[model samples]
Target: EESGSDSSQKQQSSQKSDSKGGSKGEGESENHEYISDAKKVMIEPIEAAQLDINHVVFLDPGKISITCPKDIGEHRSFIYDLETRQVVKLPDNTTVLKKLDNDDLFVMTKENTEYAILDGSSYTVKKAIMRPANVDNSLDISPDGKSIAYVTDEGLFVSDLDFQNPTRIVAAKREGKVFDMELPRFPKWFDANRIGYKVVGFKGVLYCGVVTRDGTVSKTYMEAQDATLYPLVNGDYLFRNDSGKGIGIIDANTGQKKFITESLLDKEGFAFDKNGKWVSYYMTNKEVTEENKWTGRFEVKGISSESKIMEFETEKPNAKPVENAVASPDGKFLLFTDMDMTGRRVLYKLEINAEQSQQSQKK
Candidate 1:
C-alpha cells in the first residue's frame, strides 16, 4: 500500500507541473501578440539637394509650395511638383502666408505693408490691397476669399477684398480693474461671418475668442491664459495653456474644453494632425550623473497620453534640435526645420505610417 501511494503522489505532482507550464506558455503567447500589434511605425526621411526650401505649404496631395529666402532678404516662393520632382518659381519678393480654402494663395510683401490674393495656377496677383497703418504681419483671409482679417493698434479689423468699408471687430481698451491694457493679436477667420483672435491682457494674460463680422463676441467661448489659438476646419479651436502644460481643443458649438496631455516641457514644439487625431511633440529624457549633473535627450513623441504610435530620438551629437514640426494636411507626413550635423539649416520631410488608425478618445 505504501508503494502504491508514493506512485500516485509522484503522478499528481507531475500533472500539476505540466498544467502550470501550459498556462505560462499561453501567457507568453498572448504577450507576444499584443506587442506585435502595438509596434510603432517607422519614419522615412526625404532628401532635397537641389532646392533650398525653408517653409512648405501643401497645395494638394501631389504638389507643395515652398518659400526660399533670396540673398536680398526677400523670399522666392515656388511650387514643387512631386510627380515630376520639378520646382517652378512663383512671383519674386512675395511671401506666401495662408493658403485659402479655395486653393488661392494669400501673399504679402516682405515689408508686410502690402498684401495680395494670388491665383495658384497662374501665380498672378488677382487682388492687391494696402495694409492698414500700425498693423503687423498677423493676417488671415476669409475662407470664401471675399474678406481679410487683421490686427491694428486700434483693434481687430475686417475689410472687403478691395480694402473698402473696413469694420472693427474688436477694440483695444485699458481697464484699471481687470487689466491694465488689452489688445488683439493674430486675427483669424472662424467662418464666413466670424473671426478669432488672441487677446493679450494685463500681466501677460492671453485670451482667445470669436467675434462676429458685425462685432458680436461670444461670451461662452473665451479662454483666458492661453498661448496660441488655432482655428480648425471643423469649427473647433486648438490652444496651448499659458503655462505650456499641455494642449487642448475647444468645441465651437459646445464650448467644452478637453486637454490632450499635461507632460509638456517649456519651449518644446508641438503640432496637430490636420484632422486633430494625432499630435507630435518633443519630449526630453534626463540622466543623472555621478557629479549630480543632469543630461537630456531630445526625443519626439508622435502620440497622446493614452496611446503611442511612434517615437524618434534626436540625440545625435552635433545634430541641432528640431523646431516648428508640423503635420501635413493629410496627416501622412511631418515637416520640420532643423540644422544638420554640418550646422546647415535644412527642411526635412518624414513619412508617418501606423499599424492602426489614430483616433483620439473624447473624455
Candidate 2:
C-alpha cells in the first residue's frame, strides 16, 4: 500500500510539471502572435502650438556674436538662434544667415566687396569679389553647405566656402542690364548642390533657373507674365507685387503647382512651419493712428492647402507685422524675425501645432 501511494504522488508531481510547461509554451506562442498581428502607421503634426517667443542671439557684419537681452534697442541689423541661443555679429558688410553650421558664420564685409567665414573665437578670409558701383544685393550659401554663390557687378559667381578660386556664372548684357535680368535678388538653395535664382528680361518678365554647384543651368522654374516670384524651399513660392497675391509652389520632383488666396495676397508673407507641411503667411491691412504713426497688424495662417487644412491666427486687426520667418528642419518652430521699437531684427519662436498640422500639412 505504501509503495502504491508513493508512486501515485510521483505521478501527480509529473502531471503538475507538464501542465506548467504547457502554459509556458502557450504564453510564448501568444506573445509571438501578438507581435506578428499588430500593425502601426506613423502620423506627423503640421501647425504647432504657440509659445512665449523671445530673441536668443544676434550675428552681425562686425564679426561679433552676442546673446541678446530681453530689451533690444533700435538700429540693429543682426541675426541669431532662438533655441540654442547662438549669436553672430555680421560684419559691417552684408553678412546674412547669422549662425554658420552650428558654431561658425559667414559675412560680406561692410564694403560689400569681400566675404569671410567666422566663428565666435576667430575668422578666416573667404574671398573678395569685384563689387558693382551701384547695384545693391547679398550673398547666399549652397543648400548642401559646401559653396557660396553671390553677384558682383551684376554678375553671378560661385566659389567654395573657403573662397579658393572664383568663377563667374552671369555677366552683364549691357549698361542697364546686369546679367540682363530684372529681379535683383540673391540666389537660394534647392539642394546642397543647386541654387535657384531669377534672371530678369528687358521686357520686365521674370525668369527663374536652377544652377548647379558645378555651373550647369536648368530651365526656369516659373515665369510670371509681368510679375516676379521668389522661390521657397520645399515646393512653394512667394509672388511679390503691390498686391502681394501671387504665392504658389511647384514640386521639385513632379512639377505640381498651387497658388495662395487673395486674403493672404496683399500683406501675406510665408515661412515654413516646423514640420514643413505648411508655410505660414501673414495678412495685414494698412492703418493709421491718432499719434500719427502707421500702425499695422497681421494674422498667421498655416497653409496645408493641397490637403486643405488651415490653422491658427494672430487674431487681432492691429497686432504686428510678421517678419523674417524661418523654420527649424524638424518642423517644430517657425523662427520669425520681429523688431522691438529699436528697429533691430530679432528671432522669435512659434511652436507648430502637432495633430492637425501633421495630418493636413500634406503635399
Candidate 3:
C-alpha cells in the first residue's frame, strides 16, 4: 500500500508541473520578451510647441519649407528662414532645396538654372547668374558650409561659394548605350568634402556609391532592394525595407558593410539621429492579433554594434510614426514627426537626458 501511494503522488506532481508550464507559454504571447537582456527606458509623448505656426512641415522636414497656395506650380517649393521667419519661393518650376546648410540653400529647376546657392532665410537670390539653365539638377551642401555638390547633364558637379567653374565628378553615361542610364540622384554630404549617393536601381539591385571632393568613387557590393534611400548620420548609415528586413550598416566614408538586425522581412523604413546614435525602424508580422495594437517596434541605441538597447513596442494602434526624425546638432533634443488626422505632418520635440548618457558610459 505504501509503494502504490508514492507512485500516485509522483504522477500528480508531474501533471501539475506540466499544467504550469503550459500556462506560462500562453501568457508569453501578449507580453514583450526581450531576446537578449537589454536596458529598458519608457518613452512618453512629450508636447512640441511650434516655433513657426504659419508653415506646416512637409513629407521631408529636414529642410522646412513654407506652405504655398494651391494654384502655385506643382514643381515649385519654398524654404522658410527660421531666424527671420521669411519664406522664399524659388523660381517657378523650381523645387525647394534638400540637405540644408547654415543660412544657404542649393536649388535646381527644370532648366538647370544656376541660382541654387541662395539665402535660405530670406529666399533672396544670392547667385543666379552662375546657374545652368537646361538640365534637371539636384544639389546638397557639405556639413561644414564650405562646398556644394550639384547634379546636372547626367553628371555630378561640385562648386565653391563663388560659383566659379563647376568640376564634373561623374561622367554622364556614354550617349549611345541602350540602357539609357539616368543621371545619379543628388549626392548626400557625409562630411565637408565627401558625399554619398546611389545610382538608379534596376532588376532588384541598386549600386551604392560614395564620392569625395577630389572626385573619387567607391562602390559597395550591397544592393538596396528598392529605390528609397537611407539617411546618413555620424559616420554610419542605416537601410531597411517597409517590412523591416535587410537592415544593415555601411561605413559612411569607405562603404564597408555589416548586417546589424533583421526584422519585418517584407518591408522596412528607418530614421537616425544627427549623431547617428539612435536608429528607429518599423516591423510587421501577419500573425499578430488586433489586441496587440501595432505591427511595429521602435528601437534607439548609442552605437551600431550595441544593436539592442532601448526598445518600445507601439502604443498607438494603426498609427504611422515619423521615420524622418532628426536630432539637434548637440544631440540634446530629438524631433519626432507624424501626420495628424488631416494627413498633414506635424513635428514634435523630445528632450533627452545628456547626463544619463554620460553616466551610463561610466558604468
Instruction: Give me the runs in candidate 3 sitting further than 4 Å from their true place.
Output: 1-102, 105-123, 129-134, 142-148, 152-154, 159-164, 172-183, 216-236, 239-244, 252-255, 264-269, 286-294, 305-318, 341-344, 352-363
Instruction: Write candidate 3's Cα lDDT for 1-363 as tens digits.
Output: 114543343233332234234432310111112111111111111112122212233213333543322343344355543324344555554544444546555554433444455575566666553544543445666664566677765577777754457777766564655465645665777676667665652333346556677787555435454423455555566655433454666665565656555554233224445555555455545454445424545544444543343333444455554433545455554444444433434444433443232111100
lDDT for model 3, please. 0.47
TM-score of model 1 vs. true structure: 0.72
* Candidate 1 accuracy as lDDT: 0.59
Best by lDDT: 1
Instruction: List TM-score per model, in order.
Output: 0.72, 0.55, 0.56
Please give, for residues 1-363, the per-residue lDDT of candidate 2 as tens digits: 114533343233332233234432211121111111111110111001111232222332212222222223211223433333343343433433445554455554544555555553544445444444543456676543457777655466777764447776655445654545454345666556666666655655455566666676554555333334455555555444334544455555444455554434343235554233555564433332333221232223344443323322233335455544555565554445454333443333444543442211100
lDDT of 1 by residue, 27-124 (tens): 11111111111111111122333324466666776577666665668666777665465667788888776677788888876566788889867879
Assess candidate 3 and give its TM-score to the true structure.
0.56
Candidate 1, pairs of clashing residues: none
Among these predictions, the greatest TM-score belongs to 1
